[model samples]
Target: MWSLALLFGLVVCTLSVPTGRNSPAFAIEETAEWIRYEGYVAETHNVVTHDGYILEVHRIPYGRFQTASTAKRPVVFLMHGLMAASNCYILLGPQNSLAYNYADAGFDVWLGNARGNKLSRRHEELDPDNQKRDFFDFSFEEIGKYDVAQMIDYVLEYTGSEQLHYVGHSQGGTAFLVLASSLPEYNAKFASVNLLAGVGYQNYFPSLPLRTLARLTNTIYASAVALGLVEVAAPSFFRRGDDDSIINAVPEDEYLSELSTITELLRDGADDSDNSNMFGGAALKQIAHFGQNIRDKTFRRWDYGLLENRRVYGSVSPPVYDLSLITSNVTMHYTVSDVLLDERDVLAMVNDLPNARARKVAREDFSHLDFVAALDAKELLTDYIIESTVQIENLRSTGK
Candidate 1:
């Protein structure tokens, strides 16, 4: 009876129209609603970083089906990719959601939203709206340094665990790499690190337009910053539309066919009507940092031009992030069809890391977005994540 009721409720929720507002209020409410409907425990915590940005974190201590146990469970930290918040992990619903799967497996799950996104928009002294430049002054470097470090420390303190497992998608993985490389001491805090379609060296961005944009990113971002537009939506130019936009530019038949293909890849028979809300705002500098990586073909700190670079780093160019400093067990998962991150870049990253291995996704058609939204992600990605966790536990028990 309960199962039938849940099914009915799900159908009702799916049939309802999602709100079109792109505010944090809607995102928070939607996340909470889904958590309750799925019968999961939702806890929201505000973590203040050393740099003054306040990040909003979401946690699912355990699945609804799990019984309360006195034994402390291993904790897993899941971070979202570029232009996405912690809600991405939970957007796929309970049966296929990575967060729910981790909780059901008896692992404590924590999801982190990077700064400038809807969830982590607050700061100690700066207002995001009025003080645009100060609010959005950071790039992925700051995210890795302050945001990731603080969240990990808070989770460790909250869970009373000596070490935790980390699973990062795209920029999430990049931030972890930054954290591990820049702050080598934090390497001891992680039992293992899993990077899903994570990129470090990005010389092979598959899209022609993106490659072209990378060349102009510095100019574009600097102009935007100068114009007092710091907080901007990533890929904001091509969201959804019935005319003029990329989606509308395609003919009706071709667009429908393409939509079908994408829907199949992401939704995998699940409703995707609410996916529009998943995308949020990010710092312009963050996007520019990625562009810098593409143009320079090196995973290094953000370049503030030659003059400013010398002022900041005492060098004419930014220093490269030393991947060798990462001593934690690292596993990378990539798909051949990921346009954003090329296989060559992934190989280059793997070659740099002292303790790293790379695995290609099972499907050749898997794209960058599939890591989070694919229907078969459980078999292709989540299983590997679970296996990695088990391996970490076994290694710990063996004193290795």
Candidate 2:
């Protein structure tokens, strides 16, 4: 049994690529009305960063229909990835994605939108419409250092708690890493860290199509920046709700067709399908950034257009953050068939953290989207993570 468990961990690390080969075969059906997520109500609050950007916070109260106390229920503040809105967690709500599962497990879930997106756009005294350039002016550093830190402070203040468990996916994970490194003061604010296909180390694994696109686009972006085309941001193609299998009740045929488009590969060997399972347009841009990161073997400064648009004028470009700050005990979970992030890359990331734990999920033919959207994910993917996180939290509390 010990040997099998070790082998499975390695297998999960290997299949983090976007290829459909050797993916998981099971599908999970939704039988419950997601853990009491009331969706975004009219209640709006402001969280100001030390740097001066005001992030809009929307609280989705626990399902009043269910019996649960909001007092000290271990609040979880969720941060979305690049180009993704907090609604990213909404899709997972219908059938009890992590949002539902965690809430059902008795936690007050807080979904956060990074600055510059659709919902979180607001200025202290200025309007985002007049300051369109300020809207797009940021990189992962800003999100990690400014946005996340502010959110953490806000959650702690509102909940009257010192720390809350942190969960981030992809860029969300990157932001958390930055917080741990650049802002070590906030390290103690997290009870546990859960990284879903996050980026920390980017060696050992390669996605062909995406790498090709990054190489090509970086050239285009660099040239555009040089030639006064600094107003451009990465393309946004993938949008939320594109993958309804996890949220709405889409037919299997439609789901497969959409999945094929989103999971299709580009020329260099990465999944370059036109239809992304997440938010559209901007998502492709985010992927393009990841592709570039993989090719460059380093995190990058923010694009001028993004920097200027997001309204961070005269802001110093963030350097590639040191990864050693991510020394908190972290558990990484990946599937073998993920094309964007491969198992090799996952292992590389794990090696970078001084105190990191790793686990792999089975996807004999898993694709990148299968981690969240595979109909059977609740049984296969999420259950493992849910169980693992609970175990980690318990261990943290008990020193087990």
lDDT of each: 0.74, 0.54
Candidate 1 C-alpha lDDT tens digits along 1-400: 0000100100101111123423332343366556656788888889999889999898888777554667678899999887678877876667777898888887899999889887888999999878878889999899999999999999999989999999998889989999999999999999889999886887777766556546766776666565565664423312344543234222422322233322222232223354445555577687778878887778899999999999999999999999999998899999999877889988888998999999999899987777887768889889778877977787887998
**Count: clashes, candidate 1:** 0
| Candidate 2 lDDT tens digits, 1-400 | 0000100111111111233323222111111122222432223467887766777665544543455454556667766655455545545444445666666565677777676555555557545555544454455677788888888888888878777777787677878887888877787888778777776555544555445445555555444333333221112211235543222122321222233223222111112432122331121233435545665666554444446735654554435566666666677767776655678767876777777877776657755445544556677666776676677667766877
The segments of candidate 2 whose C-alpha lies over 4 angstroms from its true place after superposition are 1-44, 60-64, 67-71, 125-130, 222-292, 300-320, 392-400
| Model 1, runs deviating above 4 Å | 1-29, 234-274, 398-400
Judge candidate 2 against the unseen true structure and give its global Cα lDDT, from 0 to 1: 0.54
TM-score for each predicted model, relative to the true structure: 0.84, 0.69
